[model samples]
Target: MIRYVHMYLVAILLVAGISMSFPSGRHSKAEAANDMSVHAKAAILVDAKSGKILFGQNMDESLPVASMSKLMTQYLILEKIQKGDLKWDDVYHADATDQDLSTRPGLGNVPLYQGQSYTVRDLYNAMTLVSANAASRALGRMAGKSDKHFVQMMNDKAKQLGLKHSSFVNTSGLNNQDLAPYQVKGTASDGENKMSARDLALLAYHFIHSFPNEMDIEKKELDQFPVTDSYSIPLRNKNQLLPNGKYPYKGAIGLKTGMNDAAGYGIVALAKRGQRELIAVIIDAKNKKGKRSSKARYMQAQKLLDYGFTHWDYQKISPEKFLPTNQQKIPVENGTKEKAAITSKTTVTELVPKNSHSIKAKLTLMPKFLTDQKKRELPSTYQPYGLIEVGASRVIPSNDRKLTELTLSFRKLLFFMLISVIPHF
Candidate 1:
């Protein structure tokens, strides 16, 4: 009967899809530091949902980001659209600077002509899909009102995003030397947009969380920019790591890639397998000869992602064992029922080691949601009403030697007294 009870519980847990992993001992930090390696000067991987750093190597050192800097440009434009300050259909004419930059040979461009009008949607597609410098520049000007102000806006956004090691000098990630007179005034002539691997990962994290729709845009293998109603420029995605690209990786999604003489090769990559999404940043990846190797960036990023996926998983908190104190429901005031049933919001996922059996979490319910007594009913919505902060710590086993010894001694004394009083029974 006991065996059947245990089997039934296991079946229920399996049916509920609750993840159960057991601890596999622990290792010292020094011992664990050498467990993973990447072929890059600096690299980092983060859990996209929780923003947890899973791995790092020289990740804090700021380095040139090349075209990867366009991420800021893309983010600002999307933000404006989200705020209703800008529209995808809004049109901007190609300025002299944008037109000239577009035609500069050797730089990635779509030959945008001066006085030629392009919609925000077109320019944005060009920038993200093909790393077109002109599209990024025009969008920056439109968003910031000028080159200098746009650079300032980029830096300001970095700060607001809590980036620790990042600086933006231009909409395009081109070295200041390449921008010539078009560069932001008063800035160093050789300065280019720079960010640490960790900063880039964090920036990508916030960008993904804030505007998830952009990921769908990044998944396209090809798009067209209409230079004229009948004439369109074919835009090919430069991110070779896409699923359909040359070096496709499973679960690969939308992201940005960049390289330059000074910055070497780098990529801010995103991938999702199962319910786990990861953001990886590889900076200045190079070959053994110490030269920028375009292929090395993607390959190294793949290895970094592999390390994350292989070593970690999105451990979910099962509703059967959710908050220990509150059961699985919350009090609902002035509703048809005194309590509203609540389940784990879309499976409360916590990033943990592959062997982690469970996560220790604390759930903080907002008082405003619980104290509203005048409402006839709680409005139904798909969005989550509260957050459960998940965390983990080592569990130290308690030593009960002293208590055991005392109990044994008391038992022996009681046994001797009972024997003296009752004799042999």
Candidate 2:
């Protein structure tokens, strides 16, 4: 039941990864509004439905992703929850080994008494909503063999997911040696995580698509964390877009946030409108420290989300016209009055705004279609070469006349022949 359908299909459609170039003036009035004036080291806007890179700037540039990397940590832990390996109510014992990097005065952390145990749900909530370093480290250690070994698991997972532009040095996104104790002492790695906006977006997109209900853990309140002793610590969601925040954007969901002198301010924000859920990765926002909290990141994320909603329209690319469609029913050989129907195999999403012209989805048909009937043969690779031009609402076919004619007539004879061409975004 480990399905790789989407990943496999995406690989086939893309000879390369997402295109990095930003859209030009030819786009619609709304799409052209993508003219962004923002501050960040790297940023990207992605359509979760189609895996389309709606917008990117310095997206491929690798840099410390800060606590944004914790989203991946949360992902690994959630995977265990989804399986039978871990449960929400399961309690873990916190000891000297669990003692975090610092007793920093105001740092987001839940104090633990020796020999006391806390539920996995409490640790998870603290990690997700408050961005607690100790919570994340504890979870990694508990989930994997050790904090050091778990860092290995993180990198291995990154390779398996095809995150080429990412590398993990620690489970918790801490750069200072004093902060992360999980890493072996005297190791070369300073314990900082690095990833490009595109790679981070891919990981977040996969997480959102795979675990729908489990992600609800983020919406919890700070006061919800259980208090073991007289120390009653309350921590609010660092993501300001969520409810009861300084600047609550409509439809904003609770996401992770990170900040440090080197990493600056960063966030991976998610929002949904009807069927579309947009993921915006804003990294390395300017930091005046307390004077400017994570507001700049939240504001930039809102802008990107606004652009995605205003600019694009989704349309399904089907091959009904490219392939011949019989009138209601096509008679089947050696069968009753029942006739078979012809349908296209390609059903994909393409993001093109309304009234946009000049965008084309060119399909390169294989050379076999151009030869004579006697000499005609499919590519030795055995892949379909039919082409589809994608646009706002049109799927323009580009193929040799002989191939078109043969397909139209032959399609009527075969009851269940599927159209070979796939409409990729």
Candidate 2 residue lDDT tens string, 175-290: 74546444654445565788888788888877886788866766554546665744456767777887778878777775678877667888888888877778898888754343
How far is 339's C-alpha from truth in model 2 (Å)? 15
Q: Residue-wise lDDT of candidate 1 within 89-188, one digit each (tens)?
A: 9999876877788889989888787778899999999999999987888898888888889889999998887776899888989998888978889888
Question: Each model's TM-score?
Answer: 0.73, 0.72
Regions more than 4 Å wrong, model 2: 1-33, 100-102, 180-182, 221-223, 229-232, 287-293, 322-347, 357-425
Lowest-sum lDDT 10-residue window in model 1: 2-11
Clashes of each: 1, 4
Runs of candidate 1 with Cα error greater than 4 angstroms are 1-34, 288-290, 318-348, 358-425
TM-score of predicted structure 2: 0.72
